[model samples]
Structure formats: C-alpha cells, structure tokens
Target: MSETTHTAATTRASGPGRLLVAVYALFAVAATGRSTVQILTRFEEAPLAYSLSALAAAVYIAATVALARSGHTSRRVALAACTFELVGVVAVGLFTLLVPEAFPDDTVWSLFGIGYGFVPLVLPVLGLLWLGRSHPRTPDAASSAPPSHRG
Candidate 1:
C-alpha cells in the first residue's frame, strides 16, 4: 500500500491512540464482568438494564479491537463502535432517569455511567475526537500542499 494509506491505517494505534485503546480495553473488561455477574445472578431483577450492560460490553470490546488494529475496516469498525456507544450511553441514561422504576439495578450506562465515574459517557466522545484528528490526509490532498524546506 501507499505511504499515506499505510500511515492512515496504522496511525490510530499509535501515540494518544494507544491510550484510547487501553481505556476501551479496560471498559470492555469492566462491563463484561459486571454484565456477566448481573445476568447470571439476577437477570430477572432488571433484564433490560443487564442486557444493556452486556451490549455495552460488546461494543467496548469491539471498539478496543478495532482501535488497536491497522486497516481501513478497523477504522470503520472503530468509528461505528464509538458512535453507537455514545448513543447508547445517552439513551440509557435518559431512560433510567425518566423511568426510574424500569431499572431497579444500575447498568454500566445508567445515569450516563455515574457508577464508573462517567467514563462511559466521556470515552466515546474522546474516541471519536481522536479518530477525527488522527485520520490521514488522502494522497491527492497531500500532493496539493506546498513543499516543506527543512534544510
């Protein structure tokens, strides 16, 4: 592949992108554990909430893997995962607030992830911003720029 394409594919996994991937991985483990215990022990207590936690876990896992890989497909997957995570957290937060009775037990996304210090709410935003900022310029765009003189 071309240098620009290679850079675009690999850039997301380097520098600040590494920290983003680490955070995503951490969330994936936390959510997975929480959801697993909730589902195995008291799924009937708050089925919707537990299920949402499971879904959040899956999204986090996907985001972590996608962000750590180098490829066009990985970039797309990461973007989609981050977008879905943002939407899910907001929707779940609102639902739990407006309908308090619907969730006797809190999930990872309840109240915009208040349980996890709001990381769930903020993580996706950060991921999206990082992705946007790290995206590589296309070759045509790069070629149109003035040459640099570093002598």
Candidate 2:
C-alpha cells in the first residue's frame, strides 16, 4: 500500500477512531439482539418496527466491520454505511412521527433514536466527520522527488 493509503487506514482506527469503532460494535450487538428477540417472540406485534430494527442492526454490523478494517474499499464501505444509517434514521424518525399509527412499537430510530440516547442519530454524523477528517493525504510532487546533490 502507498504511504498515503496506509496512513489513512491506520489513522481511521486509531485514537478516537477506536472509540467510534467500539461504539459501532456495541450498537451492532444491541440492535441485533433486540431485533432477534422481537422477531422471534412477537413479530406480529410490530412487524415493521421489528424489521426496521433488523435492518438497522445489519447496517451497524456493516459499519462496524468497515470502520474496523484498513483499506480503500473499507473506507468506501464505511462511508456508504454511515450515510445510509443517517438517512435511515432520519426517514424512520420522521415516518414514526408523521404517522404514529404506522408503527405499533418503536424501532431503533424511533424519535431520532430516543430509545438509545440519540446515538443512532448522531453516530453517522460522527462517522462522516471522522472519515472526512481522516482522508488520505496525497503526496506532493516535491515530497516524492529525489533530493538534489551538490558536487
């Protein structure tokens, strides 16, 4: 890998990035467990909500894996996952609000993730910001050029 790509990958999973990855992992587990139980126990109670929870869990899992990896593809995947998550949360949040009767129970994104302390709503924003800030630095021509020698 080029230095720029390597640096981008390493920087993405270091320091605060580690914390972000950990949080994504936590959300993945939580959403997966919640959706599984809801689907198995009482899917009929709130099929849409339960299904949405499952979808959210899948997205979280993808984001966690992508963010934890080190590669250009992983970075793209992370970006897509985070963007999707943000859109999903906003759309679902609005749906639940505009049509309260549409969802018998709450999904992870209900009321902008009120159930999860708004983490779902805020996490993607953070992920996007981190990705933006951690972009690969292009090596300039001067930096790549060989040094001149004085006779």
For each candidate in turn, the TM-score is 0.90, 0.92
Error of 1 at 67 (Å): 0.4
Candidate 1 regions with alpha-carbon error over 4 angstroms = 139-151
Poorly placed runs, candidate 2 (over 4 Å): 139-151
* Each prediction's RMSD to truth: 4.5, 3.0
Pairs with backbone N, CA or C atoms under 3 Å apart (clashes), candidate 2: none
Candidate 2 per-residue lDDT, tens place, 1-151, comes to 9888899899999999999999999999999999999999999999999999999999999999999999989999999999999999999999999998999999999989999999999999999999998999787999999999999
Full-model lDDT for every candidate: 0.92, 0.96
The number of the candidate with the highest TM-score is 2
Residue-level lDDT of model 1, residues 1-151, one tens digit each, is 7787678767788888899999999999989999999999999999999999999999999999999987778889999999999999999999999998999999899999999999999999999998888787775877889999998
Model 1 C-alpha lDDT versus the unseen true structure: 0.92
Residue-pair clashes, model 2: 0
